[model samples]
Target: MEVATSNPAEETNVWGGGTRPLNASYGKLMMWFFIVSDALTFSGFLVSYGFSRFKNIDSWPIADEVFTHFPFLHGIDAPMYYVALMTFILIFSSVTMVLAVDAGHHMQKGKVTFYMFLTIIGGAVFVGSQAWEWKNFIKGEYGALETKGGQILQFVDQTTGKRVALADIATPIATDRETHLGSNGVWYVSETELPSVSVAEVKAGFEANENVVIRIQKLDENGHKTVLSRAESLEKINAATTVVEGANLIHNEYGNRLFADFFFFITGFHGFHVFSGVIINLIIFFNIIVGTYEKRGHYEMVEKVGLYWHFVDLVWVFVFTFFYLV
Candidate 1:
C-alpha cells in the first residue's frame, strides 16, 4: 500500500477544482437543487389534476363561478377579481426580492432592508388573501343537491339566468334529526354536522318556487351548465338524495367531488409554500435589520433566499394558469 497509496482527501473531493461550481457557493447550489426537486413535485400534482379534469371535463366546476367572491363585495359577481389581485401581489413580491438582492450586491444595506421589508409585506398579504379565499370556498355561497349517483343539481332563476342560493329558495322545515356523536352510540363512530337545510326543505321550496330551474353539472355546447326545462327540473329534483351546502373531501356543491378534492390539495399545497416563504423572508429581514449579513461582508444569504422566492412565484404562475385560466 505504500507503493502507490491514494489520497483520501482528493478522492472525497466532489468539486475537482474548487468548492464553488459555476461561480455558485455551496449554499446557493444546494438551493438550486432543492428548487429543482420541488418543481418536479409541483409538476406531478398539476399533471394529475390535468388528467382528472380531462376525464371529467363536462362536470368540472367552472373556475369563474367558483371563485367569484371578493372582499366586502357581497352580492357582486366579480369573477377572478380577487384571485388576480392575489397573483399580482405575489408577483410583485418577487420583483421586490430581485431589488433586495441587487441592493445587497452593491453593499447598500439601507436599500436592501427597505426592499426586503416590502417583499415581506407582499408575501403576508398574499397569504392572508389565500386564507380568505379558502374560507369562502369551504363555506360555499350557493348550495346544491347531490343525487344518489353523485351528480350535482344546482338551482338557477330562469328569468335572471343567475344562480340561486339554497337559503333563498329552501323552505324552513322542522325536523327531529340530530347529529351523531361518538358518545351517542359506538365509541369510535361519529357523523359530521348536519347541513343547514334539509333535502325535504329544498324539495318543498323547489315546488313552491316556480321560477327556479335545476342546472345539471353537465356542460352544454356553449360551455355553460345545462339547465333543465321546468318539467324536467321537477323530475331531476326527485333524484336528489342530499342537500350539500359546501365543499368537503366527500361532497362538493359546485359539481364533481373530484374537482373539490384537487382544488383543496393543489391550492393548499401552494398556499403552504407561499406561507413558508413569507416566514423565511421575515427571518432574513430581521437578520438584515441586525446587520448579520452586513458583518459577514456579503449578502449571499439574501441571494439564496431570493432564488427560493422566485421559484415559488414561478410555480404559482403555472398553478394559476391551469386552475383558473385554463
Candidate 2:
C-alpha cells in the first residue's frame, strides 16, 4: 500500500481547494442562478407598479395615509412601523441561516440545529404579521361618500386636518332612500343596502357643515395635493356633483381603484413567496433534526436554502423603501 503519511500543504490544497473562476460549489452556483431569475421577477412587478403610480401621479393614494397602523397601539398614527418590523424579522432570519451554514461547514450539528430553529421562528412571525396588515387594509377605515363623478370627497376639519367619517359629518336622515332592491320602480333583479352615505346627502352636508372642506385628487407643482377652503370647496363640489354619474377611473374617493389593485398584487406576491420559503425551510429543518445531513457528510442543503432566504430579505428591503418610504 502507499505511504499513509502526507505533507500538510498537500492535504490543505486537496481539501481546501484554492479559489477558481466560478469557484462556487454546485449548490452555491444553483443558488446564484435562482437568485438572478427571482430578482428579475421582482423587478418586473415593481416596474409595473411604478408604471401605474406614474399614470395616476395626480391622484394616487399616499402610502403613509393608507398603511399607518401598529399593533397594540390602536389609532396611533404610526405609519410603516408594522411593515418595517416585518422587514427586520426577515432580515434577522437571513442572519440566522448564514450562521447555520457556517456551523455546518465545521460539522457542528448542534449549532446548526439551534440556528435553524431560530430561522424558522423568524419566518413564522413575519408571515403572521403580513396577514394582520392585509386584514386592516381590506377593511378600510373612515369610509367616505362616493360621488357620482367618481371622485372621493373626504370631510376634513378646517382646524385639525384629520378625516371625519361620513356619518359624523352628515345629518341624521329620517328615512334613507338608498335601497339595493327595486321596491316600487322598474325592477327585475334584487338590490341591497346602499353605501352608508350618498352623493345627495354629501352635497347637503357640504352646505350645512361650515368647518368641512374638500381635497380633490388633482396634483400641485410639488406633486402633492391641494385642499380647498370650506366656501370654495362647496362651490366646486356643487358644480361637479350636478353632471356626475356612476364612478369611473377618473373619479372615485379612493383615488383610482388601481391603487388598491397594485397594492394587493405587489404585496400579495411578496407574501406568497415568503409563505413558500417558510414551507421549504420547514422541510429542511426536519431533515436536519433527523440527521439527513449528518449521514450525507455535507451541509450543502442548508447553504442552498440560506441563499434563497437572503434573497427574499433583499427584495423586501427595496419594497419597503419604494412602497412605504419614498
Candidate 3:
C-alpha cells in the first residue's frame, strides 16, 4: 500500500510552530510577550494600592492636597496641573512614536529621524518632571507632627482655611541636641538628618499662634481633613512626640505612610520603564540615522520599539488616574 505524502507547507501550517503567528516576526512576538507580563505586574501593584486606599479611606491623603504643585509657581495651589501636563507630554510622545513607525514603514528616513527625536525629548522631559515632583514630595512643604499613636497632625490657619508651613508656624528654640552619628553613638548606628524644626519648637509656635489649629488625618463629612477647635487643638498637640517633615519609607507627613510607599514604588517603576524606553528609542534612532534598517530594506525595528512606547504611555494613563485623579 502506498502512503499519502504530506506537503511541507501543509505540515508546517498544521503544526503551527515554524511560521510567524499573526504575521508578527519573532522579535515582535517576544516584545508582545514582555508587554503582557509587564502589564500584569503593574496591575498587581495598582490592585494592592486600591485595596490599601479602600481600607484606610478616611485617613488616606487626598490626591489634590498632596499633588498641589506647579513648576515656577511656588506657593500656588495648582492641584494636578503639573501632573496633567506630564500625562499630556507622555501621550504626545506616544503619538510621535507612531509617526516615526509610520515614516519608517514608508521608507522616509528624514521623517522617521525627526519623529524619533521628538519622542526621545518627550520621554526625557517626563522623567525630569517626575524627579522634580519627587523632590517636592520628599522635601515637603508643610511639616507635620507625629503622635505616639502614629497619627499625623497638620497645622492649618483657621482664618485662611489653608495649611501652614512649619517655617511660618515654628518658633525657633535653642537646642543642644545634634544628629546621632556612628562615631559618636553606637558603633553601627546612625540617625537620619534631623527635621528642620523640633517638636518643642512646633509646640511653642502652635501655642503662640491662635489662628492656627490642628488638622487630623481623618476626613470630615465634606471630604476635608478634620480641623480641631482651639481647645481640641491644644489637647491634641500634647500627644505629638516627633516632628515629621517629609515622606520616607519610615514616615510620611502626607497622612498614611502607605500612600507615600505606593506612590514611590508605582511611579518610580513607571518612570524606570519610561527611562528604558527612551534609551531603546535612542538606539533605534541612531541606527536609522546610520541607514542600518535602510540596508535591511525594512523599519521593523522602529515598529517594535513603537509597540513598547505605546505600552509605556498607556500604562502611565492608568497610573495617572489612580494616583492623581482617583
Candidate 4:
C-alpha cells in the first residue's frame, strides 16, 4: 500500500506556504534576512571606498595625522590614541553583550538587565566620542591654503619639520571684511562665515617667517608630503586663492576632498546604526524589567538584540581598520 508522505523541502521552505521556517520564529527569521541585506549594503560602501582610495593613492590623507586630537589635550599631538581608546570601549561593550545573551539563555533576568545597562552606556560613550571627532574635523587645526587648481598647501617650520598653524604664524590684519550672505549677495550663493584669517594675512605671515616653508599635498619618494624650498614656498603661497580652515564637502584641509565625502557618508551611516541598536536595546531592557519574557518562558528578544549589537561592533572594527589604521 502506497502512503502519502510529507515533503520535507516544502515544510522547510519559508515562502512555500509553510507556517514555521527551519523551526525559526517569524520574527527571528525576519531579523536574519534584514541583517543579511544590510551586510551586503555595507560591503558595497566599503568596496567603493577602497577603489576610490586606490585611485587617489598619491593625495590620500594620512589617518593618523587627521585623527590625532585627544580630549583635554589642546596643544598635544597624540596620533591615533583617542581612537584606539574608543575601539577598546566598544570591544568591552561587546563582551558585556555576550554575557547578557548568556544570562538570557539561562533565564537569569537580573544578570541580563545589568549587562544590557552596561552595553547602553558603552554605546552612548562611543556616540559622544564620534561627535567630538566630527567637531574637531569641522573646526580644523593647522590651516592650509587652497590653490586655484584645487590643491592644499600646508605650512611647516623648516628647522623643526613640524606643522605651523596659520593662527600662530600669520600676522594680525585689520580689514573691513564683510561676509556676503544670501540677503546681501546673489540669491543662491552666500558665505557661511568668513575665515579667521585672510589669504593676504597668511601671505604676509609666511613671507615674514623665514623659518617656515610650504608643504604641498604631493607625496615624495618616501611617502611623505613634499616640502618646498624657501623660494618654492614663496611661489606656492602666491597661488593661494582661498583659506581652507577645516573640512567640508567643498573644501578639506586634508588631501583629496573625496576622502572627506566618503568619511562622512560611511561613518555617518554606521553611527545611525549604533543609534538604532541602542534604542532597540533599551526596549528589550524594559521588557526584561517588566518580566514580559519571564512570563512567556523565553528571552529570544534579548538574543536577537545581542546579535544586532555584535554586528555593529564588528562593523566598527572594519571601519576603524580602514579609516584609521590603514
lDDT of each residue in 1-326, candidate 1, tens digit only: 01223566765686554333366677888999999999999999999999999999877889999999999999898998998998999999999999999999999999999999999999999989988988999999899999999999999999999999998998998899899889899988887788888999999999999999999999999898899999999999999999898899999999999888988999899999989998999999999999999889899999999999999999989989998999
Decoy 1 TM-score against native: 0.93
Q: How many backbone clashes does candidate 4 have?
A: 0
Model number with the top lDDT: 3
* RMSD (Å) per prediction: 4.7, 6.3, 4.0, 4.1
Q: For all candidates, what are the clash counts?
A: 0, 9, 0, 0
Point out the higher-scoring one by lDDT: 1 or 4.
Answer: 1
Residue 8 Cα positional deviation in candidate 1, in Å, after optimal superposition: 22
Off by over 4 Å in 1: 1-16, 19-21, 187-189
| Candidate 3 colliding pairs | none
lDDT of each residue in 96-212, candidate 4, tens digit only: 999999998899999999999999999989988988988998888998999999899999999999999989888988999999889987789999789999999999999999999
Per-residue CA lDDT of model 2 for 1-326, tens digit only, reads: 12234666756575554433465776688789989999999999898889988887878777787788899999789988888889889999999999999999998999999999999899889989988887777656665544455566556788888876666666655565656567656687554435566666667776788888887666688866668887788776764442122223332344566766766777788888888888989999899999999998988899889888888888889888878887
| Model 3 stretches with alpha carbons more than 4 Å out | 1-13, 16-18
Compare candidates 1 and 2 on TM-score and give the better one: 1
Arrange candidates, best lDDT first.
Answer: 3, 1, 4, 2
| Residue 31 Cα positional deviation in candidate 3, in Å, after optimal superposition | 0.7
